[model samples]
Target: MNGDIKEDIRSLSLTDLEKFFADQNEKTFRANQVYEWFWKKSCRSINDMTNLSKPVRKILEDHFSFPVLHIEKEYISRDRTVKSTFRLHDRLMIEGVLIPDGNRTTACISSQVGCQLGCTFCATGLFGFKRNLAFTEIFDQVVELTNQSLHHFNVPLSNIVLMGMGEPLLNYEEVKRAILMITSEDGLGMSPQRITLSTVGIPNMIRKLADDHLRIHLAISLHTADNVKRSIIVPLNKKYPLEELRDALKYYHEKTGKRFTLEYLMFANMNDSLSDAHNLAEFCKSFPVKINLIGYNQVPDLDFKRPESGKIIAFKEFLEKKNMIVNIRKSRGEDIEAACGQLALKDRNQREG
Candidate 1:
């Protein structure tokens, strides 16, 4: 934290904003002006905020920088999925993706450097736990990625997905703050309906998100239904099993009346069998949810492999026979390693190599 160029202003909330203005011997109106620049305009440098006096800008710049990650490497897929790694002030790096569909562009933002969940099939989890991202850093990702791909992305981030590096719910408060900032009209001007947070079934946070009345969609990473197989792949299943997860989803639907999605990744012989698909359909019968069958993107150095095209077709057909509405998701960035579970390159890793 000491070495990182952490700007003090980045940590200020609504109350802290007033405090900072008072501490700087300025009127409270100054705080609101700065908030407009940061939240509304998404300004990075102090010089960009022209409303503030030159003397005031100088004081703020000397005290705090606009904590944002500079773009390090950008990889564009042939299909137009752009994945970029950003280097933070501390030299720590994170990845953000701009996935362009027919008329919509979704920005997949990361909540942390690495993951603590340790899901066996995921490349991000394989890296192990790193600290959660700060609020400023998290916000910077959305703004920066949007600015980077403005020319191409059909929509200005029609959807905001927390399906990147870390387990978003584990970094609860920061994720909550980031969501609030995204949803606030004064800020990113994003509608909550457009945002979807994908989790490996964090029960408590699921119910908490529902309780808070956030209208965002929930996508649960339910790779398997068998407790034994699920535990082997997703370690968090030991804490919150299928039964508990079912109850939580039930509660969430009851509270929000929103239909959640069950994200099942297809891994060759692992969880792509006909019986496994049947188990998944049976598992979700108790809750109101749709199924999004994601075809895995093979990561280098990972043991898990993507299922065959025939296997994907057979599994989707089997689920459909069970009256389940399932859509087989196309892999977005295979050529550039920017697809589902394939964002592993970082500035530190590059430097070390």
Candidate 2:
């Protein structure tokens, strides 16, 4: 095939690859060998598959192309957190983070270049949406972050979170494919329990996730329980109100029988009051849930301020009094703009210049 007509080899499934080899009068096992190189070995080029014959490798190179992501720039925080800006084949960019704590290292990967949801407090949405990432692009982020962890912290990546730059559920198929490859025995071989997909609460997608029964964790970014305030903070809330979201989550629990996580970003005098805690407890009543009260990471031009420590403590105490599980997640990598709600492209002008 000509370069103009060639497609990404990673886009093909095993069955498709097997058939392609057979059509070329090659042994079908060549597909198996090549598949292992692609997923299990994480080979960047067909030339890297040493087990394949030179003729076979030449044929593969002629027929297919493997798109690879390059690490354009990296920033390391004082806390030892690493943020990477990946340059795609088309020259577009996205960010991923490596967060290390004690014995565990988590790779926070993105599902899209930029976010479509314009959360007032987020920096990614300030640049507007670019495009959804392909499954291979998403997987490449994990591969690089895993390498970063071993090089920097001398430990294997213990967990993976799809909580970096975009609304994951919006890019459904690509995100799902990336997760399957991340957890598949033929791929990274990590356990599904070590992976989490965080969304800003997409009701239909939440129900669809339940039906898929992926067995990975699902997290909803519920900043507030009050609908009026939520709509102002998360603009998507007006379209998918709390009542409908509640019904969808109820259906999810009934189907999967699994506990989900609710992420609440704390902002002073905004949603950190005792009354807000009561509403949150009432919302969690419908299903088994864990609450993560995250400190607000100040983004430039965003007026949201982190709540006082006393107020956050009181709010957590109130939730615990309701017998609810709660954890206060202190902001990590704030100095490097790599914490939650802080991942975005900072050199847009330089890139386009």
Question: Using Cα atoms with residue i matched to residue i, what is each candidate's TM-score against the true structure?
Answer: 0.93, 0.98
| Candidate 2 per-residue lDDT over residues 277-319, each given as its tens digit | 9999999898999999998999998999999999999999999
**lDDT value, candidate 1, whole model:** 0.84
In order, the Cα lDDT scores of the candidates are: 0.84, 0.92
1-353 per-residue lDDT for model 1 (tens digits): 25766445767776787787798898888888888888888888888889889999898877776656788888898999899888887777778899988887889999888888888878887777667998778888989877865777635777889988898888878888888888898788889888889899988888998998878889999989989999999999999999998888989999999999999888888898988987898898877778888878877677888887899999999988878888988888889877777776634574222
**Top TM-score model:** 2
Candidate 2 residues lying further than 4 Å off, grouped into runs, are 1-5, 349-353
Cα error, candidate 1, residue 159 (Å): 1.1
For model 1, the stretches where C-alpha displacement exceeds 4 angstroms are 1-7, 346-348, 351-353
Q: 267 in model 1: Cα distance from truth in Å? A: 1.5
lDDT of 1 at 132: 90
